[model samples]
Target: MADVEEMLDQAREMPYGEARSILLEQALKAAAHDRELAFEVRLELTEAYQYGAEPAKSFATFSRSVAEYDADPGRWSDWHTYSLLWQFKWIASDMRRFPEIPLQRAYDALEEMERRYTQAGYGSHAIHTQRTYVAEHIGDRAAADEWFHRWQTTPRDDMSDCEGCDPSGKVWHLAWMGRDEEAIELAAPVVAGHLTCHVQPQGILSNLLLPYVRTGRLEAAAAAHLRAYRLVQGDANYVDDFGDHMEFCALTGNETRGLEILQRELPLLDRSPTPSDRMHFAGCAALLLRRLEDLGHGGLTVRRDGSDVPLDRLRAELESDARDLAARFDARNGTGEQTRRLEARLAAEPLVEHLPLTPHARRVAIPVTQPVAPPPPPAPPSCSTWPRRPGGAATSTPPSPRGSVTTPSAARRTGGARTRSGWRPSWKASRRRPCGCGSARPSCTGRRATRCGGRSRSAGSACSPRTWLWWRRPTGGCSRTATRAGAAARCPAWPRPTRGPAGPRKRSPRSRARRRARCCHCWPSCRSTSPSRWRRPARPGRR
Candidate 1:
């Protein structure tokens, strides 16, 4: 018989989280007092929250176990009895968070368990189970199957009865690895056989549903998932209710419900004392969100105020709460990366846009017809031949020149002008001339320009030089010389002034210097400037 006091002593030396499993088992195996096992039991239940966001609490527990065994290895003889249970719990919890633990660590854990059992001699069944697990985890399906066969054939104790539960577990592993047919075959018997067994069968059955889903037997998958759901409550063994339920919902395309459950469960689980617990919950939440998005559904959902809001909205609300909590908590002594990570996770939720405005929500009136712009004036008629002035020297009463125009108002009429009010004879010429200071000189003062079309009492006063050169009539009192002066004053273009000496050209040294720097800031186009000076600063107001 195992020594109960020695086992409790073994547990008392361990950290509560690690010690709890062994202590509780020892309490049962030895019928030890309640006070001795209570502490470890509580610690075991809270282990997940204690290891928040960590990959596994088993690693820490295993590390502690190794240290304790190193001092005296025999203390673990009975402890190894619970090795499979602890390892399974560890692996389940670990996988929920860090699915990618290094292959070597897994191999070592399996090898270590094998070595311990080989030394113990009576642990061959447990050894086979663990070996199969390791082999499967490392992608050795054939080896895993061989070990599973070995587990089936190996001799039994009362502890070995639990080994059948492992086949259901194997089904999940096979399904995950894409060997669905084999997984289903292995799971078929247990699905029917083990439901009546003494051991709580939810863990393995839930695991088997994955294979059924993967194999495309949706009806079978749904049946198994619902069965597992009913089987997990108040179990003698472990139950990942939220995670299993999530898998069930996701595979069946009940995404909306899956997300709703996740949003609800995540917070309640985070309050668990073990860090490992928090990681498990967080990892599940993350995985569910990721899976929903993968399946083309939006992530989780939540109830806000009175309505069902998307997870994104709920997360935003939480993030605002986190800032207030952070300030209130005096974070220096409280949870470290965990609080920060939780806040960050809450903040990472995508921003949600509210629903479209309803008719009742609107307070302002909108115009029915967009305000129409006033219709533009009709355009002038374009002509291929030069316009003729009536009763002029050109072709009628007299003969002048082809390019010359009549008075400005008469010129406008022949150009076939159109006006906003109505067509007018002088409108075309009146519209074409610049009325402001910044008009371009050459184009406006060329041989093409017509004389101002309004009737004029004066000679050249009413007509510019361009008009005299191009006009047909010279009735204005203003002299033609004054018109020439106006053109010369306004423009310094080509064809030199016809009647007077040219004006002196004034220049500014400052202006010349400034003009040279114009393209200094523009590279490539102004290659004369050095490349380094391409970004030269503007000289105060000069640009």
Candidate 2:
């Protein structure tokens, strides 16, 4: 029989997947005769299973370690025991991903961790942090808020996540609260090249990408994507990170860049063992591919499994896969939170008109308002179009210039939609307020009101507000002057607050009244509609 130490070393050298998992399994069996060795082998095996191709098995491995430690506490060292406790969070989080596991099981896992931590004289920081994740996961905002506060107030101990990870968690929660400004502010310390770690800058940078874009920090957003993606690439543990980068590219008019990211990451999709990571990756891939299709690149193909797969087919497969996985998560959680969040992600608009990316990108400024470029004259006969890869290689046509954005018409050009200011919060999108295009929003089957509800009221439906596409119109009865006026619906191109926690958060009465007073109630039934009457939103403080 192979020495367990030798087997574990071999497994570590191997890449993360079924093969590595199998090797660790064998080593676990070999170490079973030696209780101390078995505990050591069990801890290592759990980490492999947690990140390898079969993540569900990790919990099973973790379970055995716990039973052994409890059964003979004198046999295990403090190092082995602490190692097992640290993994409690991993089990708690991943258990919620599968539909088969009841949510109660996840909470039980957390309670177990808390009990053990308290017995060991550890601080409550890690326990409260995990409780926050559980509450937030199930869409229980009040409970999540209470837990988050406790997590914040509890002092860190030997068991809390490293300096990098703790702050990264805070950044994500802040972004979730729809406080992009605060999220970015909190991330500055990590982003300033201080306190770096494998997870630090990557985790911090990915969380801030969309926040920076939504706040008109286009250059910062671009820089973040480039910096963060490099760290996460090719790591099985960073599957969630890859999905975030893909979503960033899709939202920043970098579909081609997204395609490049897709080509690199798609092959590793099956290698990822966690259901939640796979779900996130599929959803983001579908988002990027949808943008490609919208830009007339539906015919384009990506190389997969030694053959080219058309992106349209790829998009359909990913969307179905995402929804299916989301359904499973929703079934388990019973709140439909994952499903609703996925739909929001699929429906979000770009935050930037044409923000550049990476080392090769050029500085592009988005004006508050610019002359609508006249639709280019019909392509001259023989002016053929070609699909160009980000590396400057052309796949098809001969006449088009290199590095051109693949948009169809000036009016419908992908990425042409621009925000008026940095204020396209997705609450407006979630409201599904009707655009003047006269096309009724389909998802909003809710009972339509004959009179516009303005901002605070909703009729009969749970359907979403609308897509990223919308047009603006000017109205006269508005208390706020018509700069980015309420006469028309907002654009679908603006970045909606997808991960922010505060999207559907309840508003204060004073804030609610303030929102009501800003717009006219002339939508869906107003007879007056004219472009000539439209005016640019007033510059702040301008008379």
Candidate 3:
């Protein structure tokens, strides 16, 4: 027993790989001398092999531990029970990496552990969560939901050891169900707390990006993406989470960087990648490339490790790989109905489709064709309420006779203007015109009015008689409606100079030549008559 303890200590301290494996092997040999010690050593060996990424070896060692435990069914300890349950959880995770191993095998292992040690009092939450995750990957949504509900409802004992396991699974479940806000609310604090674990930080933050982006929390989403990227910076086995991270980069204006990472990781992924991993990476790559293309960046070349390839070609390659992976899955899994369905989903046409990113509801201002007219004068005020003058004093003066011309001071006081012909309502008064900018603010209407052809002219300009026309022409152009009878007729064909001498400026030969070249370049059909003069001179060796 002392020798076994020393071996375990050495194995734990040593870095993973050959050295630790040797120490663990020695411990396993020493443990065999006693049945109880052998059981303990076998558990440690299983964990060591798992951490070393030797799933097959870990699975075998774990089977041996289970066998040893079964041999002495009548005698059991809490440590043995807990070890068995932990092994069961990890086996499910292993099954994901090795699809040939039926997931049911892991499910049965957990059930056997539960039956053999019912009194050991292990919390069933972790087990249920693992089973739910397995069921989801295997396309058993109904069973997954059932197990998830069981996990959520299970009571945790004070002695439960896996307190940090809930966030990742819960966030994924809630996000999948479209309860994104609730998921974000639950996950944000946990991520901020900086918990460190294989499934956490990286896993939680990766999944959190989905809801964060959907809710328009772009800054939070960007932070989560960066944190997740740092967490898995060089870890290639995290291919499962790489897809989500790439998605975050693509959606948040980092598609180039995401492609660079993909190229760097391609070699690693090509070595021993599972069908699922390949499928996921391919999907993410295709989607990111598609997004880049949609943003008018098509034909962009990605250069990495001395190789250059256009994004379109990369997308095509990924799509082909995805299809091949789906075919392999179908071949291995057989043509059963469920396998067929899963394969179809995996190989569906349109390798990449945009994910729905819903934005918050807010009013969007659209350009109005005609300016909004100001409100009409209030129906002649009732005698009950006396009209107040512009100076805010109650006016005893009876309403001006319908067409009477009043002094400018009287017009200002009455909120009306007296033109030479008649009295105009307050809205029609020059001072109270609506701002034609489409903003509802009454003060902005005439502050900066646009002239003919949408040209913005300063207020009180005498160039043209400006009416509130929402549709203005481009600057220096005449408006069609204005030219018909209003502002356009009075406005010059081109804006008159505000200050400089108004005649055309003389151009130097060089400037004239530059203008001619520009005109020819912009309109190819209008090529310059002296093409040879504008053409570049030939190099010594070139024609």
After superposition on all CA atoms, what RMSD does each candidate show versus the true structure? 24.4, 29.4, 21.2
Q: Arrange candidates by TM-score, descending.
A: 2, 3, 1
Residues 1-543 of candidate 1: C-alpha lDDT, one tens digit per residue: 246556656655664343455454445445435432433333343343233322344455445444544575554445443543344435433432332444455556556655654655645666676666655544456787798778778876433435456566566666756777987787666677644353335556667655666566656765666566565433212224555666455445554555666655554553443333334344445544554555444543555445776755543444444444333322322234335544444333322111111323322221234579999996432223333435534432122222222222334445744332222335345334432222222334443433232233222123422222222232221222333335334432212323446665544544322232221111112223323422223334543
lDDT of 3 by residue, 1-543 (tens): 898888888888886555677788888887777888778778878877766535567878877777777787668787677677667767766665555765567667667645543556556666677677766665566887898789878876533334455677888987876789989877765687754455567778888886887887776776787777778765655675777777665665665566666776666556423557667777776777776777667757766446888878878887777666655554544433234433444333331222222244232222224578999875432223333325676534222211112223323554754443223335334333233232223343356663433455545332221233211112212221222223223322222324448765665555543333221112111123324433332334544
What lDDT does each candidate get?
Answer: 0.45, 0.69, 0.58
Going through the candidates in order, what is the number of backbone clashes in each? 40, 15, 10
Q: For residues 94-164, could you state the per-residue lDDT of candidate 2 as single tens digits?
A: 88777678888888888888899999889889988888877777778788879878888888999999887
- Tally clashes: model 3: 10
Model 3 spans > 4 angstroms off: 1-5, 14-38, 74-77, 117-119, 158-161, 194-199, 271-275, 292-317, 324-543
Ranking by lDDT: 2, 3, 1
Error of 2 at 533 (Å): 79
In order of appearance, the predictions have TM-scores of 0.39, 0.64, 0.55
Clashing pairs in 3: 434-445, 435-444, 435-445, 436-445, 453-472, 453-473, 453-474, 454-472, 454-473, 482-488
The worst-scoring run of ten residues by lDDT in candidate 1 lies at 517-526
Distance from true location, Cα of 35 in model 3, Å:
5.3
How many pairs in model 1 have backbone atoms within 3 A of each other, for residues 3 or more apart or on separate chains, i.e. clashes? 40
